[model samples]
Target: MYSLLQRLRSLRHGFWYGVSRRIRWSRGAFEEAPARELCNVDPEPAERIAALRDRYQVQFELGMSAATSRNNYEYLDLLDRGWSSLGIGRPSGGVLCDIGCASFWYAATLQAFFQPDRLLGVEVEGHRLFRDGRARIDYAAGYLWRLPNAEFVVADYTRCLLPADLITCWFAFLTPAAILAWRLPLSLLAPERLFPRIRHNLRPVGLFFMVNHGPAEAALAEGLCAAAGLRRAGRWSSPAALSRYRMLPSVLSWWRAG
Candidate 1:
């Protein structure tokens, strides 16, 4: 009698399990729409677009945000207090180039913040977002074409270009200083090889904003630039939202020899 009762319980569980599996299977059986009906494509442009589909799916996030601009604003606000002491004036319509500019958010903020006349943004990746001719900021997408005014290059980043009144290489450009604390070779070699080319592109008192994603990077940037004769114009840091919001990242901008 005990064995018979046990057999009946197993049967009951198995029956319900089978029924659940069938329901799930029924819900999951779906068919894709026909290609001709679902897609609107012409023969020529459609084929050209298809070739670009693979290229359009790339993404890079530099962890910059409006909060960063807010932080910049606050720092400037503080600086305003000591403008006389520092002998500083508001940044004017100077040509600025953002090397390794991703998404161009900070680039736009730069124009809004400092009111520079021409802003040059160079990134290795496709400039899908910033390339529209209608974009308020003058932008050239998909090329590292040299411009007489100011130039930004996306490749290797070791090459030289036109001089600038000010140059900003945000977090991405400067490696974390902590990395150097651990690895001295990179700390010593990289910044030196890259400096002469960069220094060659600066005016007598041109400003360089080397923003690093880490504190250690800030130290490295200072050391490297000082070694290369780029004096420090000003140094300050503000709390960043990247520490709060998960997606955002922060860096220290080492304004060199302005």
Candidate 2:
């Protein structure tokens, strides 16, 4: 009975995935504008928040809702702390690619943190709750419309990618259990292929940054990077506080392409 139920769920998800792709293609060009009202700030120390704002020039507002705004701020904080701890400095104008960027919740934070001349968010899944309603791609594009250099693409990272000066993958699914939990097709779980592609697309000396759920996943990811011949740059366990929710402390790691 359990096997049968799992099969049924997979079929349902597969059917919807095909339908969503067709709908997305038929929708014509996607158009978006900057969110009208950008008003939400983190309640961190005044000086710290101000310093971040001054450095990144990011307001950390999604303009979608207060909840999303707050979430963005939290991500911004995480990125700042993680990158600083790793001894990675902000990059000048260059290309950046973020893999597994579902809904691109941190699109603004990434744009501000890296200050990339071109920011591309790549995701394999573009599922929608309803056929006619908005999809994950819609949310990403809308949220990033304010940043002229930021764009999102629905594609498999293992199959295709543009060369980039910097690459980031946040909480990528490393185990089969993680993929099933997200209801993604099992075929999409291809760390072996994904890591190689990431290394190939990274320009020489370019940075590849990743964040994992905890020490276990971090170890798995580190091994993959090593197999791909990426030189380990730095690793740190983020200690930033995410007051909105509870979870295991995140582990951050970065590698440089030879």
Candidate 3:
């Protein structure tokens, strides 16, 4: 009975996924507009912002909306903490790829923080259209059109061809429950195969940074990376809450390819 129910759910989700993909493809790409505003959230503390600037030597710009501004600050804070905790310095110039980047929402923040010579946001579902408040827009296209050095590709990360000096993956699905929660087909859950591909695409001594939802996910992710032969460089969990959301604390970990 359990197997039967799971099959039924997969069939239902697969049908919807096909339908959505066709609709998005039919719409084609829209003219790049101003990036959309994210959902409303409280702004980061002013003192925290000052601290991030001092530590990272980076500046923040006011976002198109209050929510966007707040999100920008949060991302910066997260990256600052993650890098510092890992004892890694900012990269001078190299290719950086962000895997499973839903909408590549934080492209600008990444560009500023890493200052990479090239930045790529790779997503399996690249054709997903998002309403950016003004109009329906293709997130990847909009970012590609606006950011000169950034590129967005629609492809499976496991098969990505470009080698990267730095890779960032935020909340990659590692369990069937997590995949189903996102309405993705269970077959897409492949952490066993995914970690090795991530390691394969990294240049020698490249850095792979990941953020897991909570302690459980972090443990699973760390184990998978270890099984794939990636060396753990550092791990950290923020002492103070960073976002207004009441979800579990995000755990940041970094690995190096030998």
Highest-lDDT candidate: 2
Q: CA shift at 199, candidate 2, in angstroms?
A: 0.5
| Whole-model Cα lDDT of every candidate shown, in order | 0.45, 0.75, 0.74
Between which residue pairs do clashes occur in model 3? none
lDDT of 3 at 69: 47
What does candidate 1's lDDT look like per residue over 22-42, in tens digits? 442212111212122213434
Deviating ranges (above 4 Å) for candidate 1: 1-87, 125-153, 173-189, 240-243, 246-258
Better of 1 and 2 by lDDT: 2
**Better structure of 2 and 3 per lDDT:** 2
TM-score of predicted structure 2: 0.84
- Candidates in order, TM-scores: namely 0.49, 0.84, 0.83
Candidate 2 — which residues are off by over 4 angstroms?
1-8, 25-51, 130-132
Candidate 2 — number of clashing residue pairs?
0
What's the lDDT of the predicted structure labeled candidate 2?
0.75
